[model samples]
Target chain A: MSLAKRIIPCLDVNAGRVVKGINFLGLKDAGDPVEIAKRYDEQGADEVTFLDITASSEDRGLILPIIEQVSSQVFIPLTVGGGVRQVEDIRTLLNVGADKVSINTAAILNPQLIFEASQKFGSQCIVVAIDAKRAATPSGYGVFTHGGRKETGLDAVEWALSCYQLGAGELLITSMDRDGTKSGFDLELTKKISESVGIPIIASGGVGSLQDLVDGIKLGGADAVLAASIFHYGEYTVREAKTYLRDHGVEVRL
Target chain B: MSEIVIVDYGMGNLRSVEKALQQVAPLQSIKVTSDPQLIRTADRVVFPGQGAMPDCMRELKQLGLTEVLLEVANNKPFLGICLGLQMLFEHSEEGNTHALGVFKGDVVRFNEAQLFDECGSRLKIPHMGWNQVEQSMEHPLWKSISNQSRFYFVHSYYVREKEAIASGISRYPESFTCAVARDNIFAVQFHPEKSAASGLTLLENFVQWKP
Candidate 1:
């Protein structure tokens, strides 16, 4: 039996609504997070990630209701990230039916939070997201926080190793350099981190085509591939991506 | 319609399981609870959990569910998922935790040395993501789900059955028991709620299954 790779469709939500391309051609409501998540589920997405990009504290509570609504209807794993600063945030998300919580800045600020959160909630639910950019550091990729606007000066590979050691169940590695470029995932960055750690790695950032998803697993050595624009703007269905990956000899859950 | 009570010892997310059940058995009442009395009164018991085995055992004890779960598993139609499956065995390699010993097996962690496929590529631990399960025995829960259907799995340790109770097996570079069944008990190493259609089919079968 083969372990099929996963395809996750990420939804950048703001104020409890899906952001990043609010003007999709066919969606009844582009901003409805639940509708978008349900659509992804219907498309056979392995998992759906909701990145809360809300800027204000009052808007932060918006994601909870959205997650609760989605989890009730969509029968799949939902991972919520963005603005997860403490253990309470993780708890709040999990309680509302989020299967996993991704911690980025808070994890860098207090690596112990990873340890504590993992110890308390089990590492399976704690995902550490690393935004890496091409740099002149020893590992050649430096970790960036605050939505890739702030550089932590931490070597991406070294930091990945430490995070695994600190009890992160999985790592979501995103390359800031190729994030919006749509060229493809930074194969070098994903390969280095995947080879260094024993946990599963989710390759994110740049995904312009179906071939990029294949490369994320085959060449980049990622266990899962996350894409937004590729599936967001009605460019490609999640099924099409999986079908391409399967034809290209990559195991997917289609 | 019978009520299905999901044991919640504060382990992992149960809403997904509860919601999935609601989808399949809309008429049946499904409850996510830690109350021993509520669990004992249910027609079917769902033991769902995640995290470290030691911590799970501690929480089960703290909630005084060790005896309650054992009693229900022996007497009623019980469904276990993930850690719920692992906790049925006699012992687990994780933190050297002792399980409920409902079945004759040992929960062992996957050996790092043997985690390589035919291509000689090393496999990651936790065995995260979707994997195909080869049916090993006949069971009602396998209804409508084709043999060797893919299911979502995310765990480091697996069951090494000392008896012939393994109902399904999956290979993570090496073959391991991913499902077990005996009498009224059905347990799986993967999450049916997160495994898409085939997984939902399994849960649907469980809802209508007599055993």
Candidate 2:
């Protein structure tokens, strides 16, 4: 039998600590990433993903010590993203014990980079991240890159399909419009891309309650669900999320 | 003082297992040990695993644990979790790996297409979460546990037993075996340590169970 569903808590690292904000405004420091990750691991999170929101803009390498500290503390899988533009960056992340490396703006600029990285480290090691926002001009959503600063005018659903074809083993799709709003996930957006791709899809953004997570999986058709504010500010824990999912008939690691 | 020896094969979640067992039994009685002699002398043993099945089985053989594990399975209470449960199967489709052959049949990955059809919904891979189990109440390990309670699970592959060895089953897009038991050997695909109160109670029952 296949394993149950997983509850994942995402941490956005700006300057070595967890931070959260609506529409990326009024950034507030949550806590140390390592400490927060350890708590989630203790609460039974299947895995944790860390996004260095400022690493690319700052032109600095990944915070290796932080990654090392967290990896040593938690036994579950860890995924690192942001400022990961080249194959060497992926190598560095993996060497630091990150189970997977997620690429966003860099992969958009060089689509073939996905194929090359997958070939070097295997497909399972590569994750393609797509940030999307609703566009008024086209009356639909388009892909956004570079921390949601650049709009590609490309359809979000189509971009996901292309990323998979380019050898991305997994996809992390975050809705910029819905992010931090806590209204609920963009189920329509998640469903569109999920239906078009075969690889694992991690639905992110606008998660206010446990029902949002279950709705994302059952209605949006996502494989895994990722939340930031709910987990970061202690609105609920990984254990509570899993229990809620279990009660709702959604499979999750208890 | 009944002692429970958790085999440390240098892979997977070791601390969580230790913590869960401690919550169920006395912390003094649960010891995470890599020493084969300690495991052989323990009243019960737990084999926990993550990652690929072949690598884990190889490490067990390299540490000369195959014979020790078989002896424990034959004479003592043996519990397997996740990849630990897969290792007890005959073989695994992952990397074409061969298992301990303790239970007949092979471990295989979930066919996503088939699962979607069965559940009428898109199913994700690497199933992770707290899920409900359809279990037989007669099993000692499940004593006092109701049918509505859930357990934590994280795995991508499952066992396909030749004959019925399962004592409990869970539905995830499709019905699948969640727990298996035969003779003195018992295994659960879910992680009791991660599962919270219901899971902790299951472990406590196992600690006090006398077959």
Task: Pick the lDDT winner.
Answer: 1
Could you tell me the lDDT of residue A53 within candidate 2? 73
For candidate 1, write residues A45-94 as lDDT tens digits: 99999999999988899999999999988877889999999999999999
Expressed as tens digits, the lDDT of each residue in B117-192 for candidate 1 is: 7766679988888899999998889988899888989999999989989999998887889999998899999999
The global C-alpha lDDT for each of the candidates, from Candidate 1 onward, is 0.91, 0.78
CAPRI-style class, candidate 1: medium
Q: What DockQ, on C-alphas, does every prediction get?
A: 0.78, 0.14
User: What's the distance in Å from true for residue A197, model 1?
Assistant: 0.4
For model 1, state the Cα shift of residue B179 in Å. Answer: 0.6
lDDT against true structure, model 1? 0.91
Clashing pairs in 1: none
The C-alpha stretches of model 2 lying farther than 4 A from their native spots are A1-129, A133-145, A150-171, A181-184, A207-219, A230-254, B1-3, B23-26, B29-34, B117-119
Measured with C-alpha atoms, the lDDT of residue A45 in candidate 2 is 85
A-chain TM-score per prediction? 0.97, 0.90
| Best candidate (score: DockQ) | 1
Interface RMSD of 1: 1.2
TM-scores, in order shown? Answer: 0.97, 0.69
